[model samples]
Each structure stands twice: as C-alpha cells, then as structure tokens.
Target: MKLISLLFIILLRFDGTTASLVKESSDKNTVYVCGSGKGKRYHLNENCRGLKSCSAKTIKTTREQAQKEGKTLCGWED
Candidate 1:
C-alpha cells in the first residue's frame, strides 16, 4: 500500500539521521572528572593539574553529558 511505502521511507530517513548522530558523537574526544569535587567540574585532560590531588575515583564522560549535569571546565584546562 502507499502508506506502507511512505512508512518505509520515513524509517530509512530516521535510520540515516540516527547513524549520522552516532558518528558525530563518537568523533568527539572524551572528557574526565575528579570525583573528589562537587561534580560541577570537568576536564579535557585526565592529567590536568586541577586533578592532581583528586582523592576519589576519576570518571570518564562525554562533554555533552557533563554540560547537562552542570559541570564546568576546569580552570587549569580553561
């Protein structure tokens, strides 16, 4: 039917869009955070000076997720 063909076209478009999004996200570099802080800070470099004295575990996360969680760039890296 025409409706079925239209639905298939829409599904293909959605799949292509999803694939592009995944590729873009994966192309970005990963960020890190020192869990010792208030979780409001993120660093592009794991060895940033600001993280030198981290007393807790370090976590790896994406920049977008960090921003959503209200994390700011570390002064040492900014």
Candidate 2:
C-alpha cells in the first residue's frame, strides 16, 4: 500500500535521525588512562574494568592526545 510505504520511509528517516542524536550525545572526547603500557589503553569512563586493576594513577586526557601517544580504546569500555 502507498500508505505503508510512506510510513516506512518516515520511520526509517526518524530512526536515522535518532541514531545521529544518540551518537552526538555520547561523543566522548575525554578519556581516562592509567600511567602504564606505553599509553596503549584508554577508557571513555573511569569505571571501566580495564582501569579497575590499574595500580597507577588514572589521568584524564583527550582522545586525540591518547591516540597520538599510541593509545587505543579500552576493551572493556568500547
């Protein structure tokens, strides 16, 4: 039916817009890291399991700086 098709298109468009909004809201530029492993693991949240066992200090830094130092997303957080 034409109505069904139109509804589908509208739903699809709305879903896409909602997804973009969620992504924008969750945009985490700041990362938490422990001073170890050559800066290889960075977490978007401080409570990530990857940092739970960390004995060193958990410092906050930007994602760009973490990447520049060869850090990757923490397995537990991302």
lDDT of each: 0.76, 0.78
Q: What's the true lDDT of residue 11 in model 1?
A: 73
Candidate 1 ranges beyond 4 A from true positions: 1-28
Clashing pairs counted in every model: 0, 0
After TM-score superposition, the amount by which residue 3's alpha carbon in candidate 1 deviates from its true location, in angstroms, is: 57
Worst 10 residues of 2 by lDDT: 17-26
lDDT of 1 by residue, 1-78 (tens): 999988866676579875554544465667888776576788876667887778899987888988888888988777
Off by over 4 Å in 2: 1-27, 37-39
How displaced is residue 4 in candidate 1, in Å? 57
Q: Write the per-residue lDDT of candidate 2 for residues 1-78, one digit (tens) a residue.
A: 999988866676579875554454477787888976555799887768888888888997889999988889988766
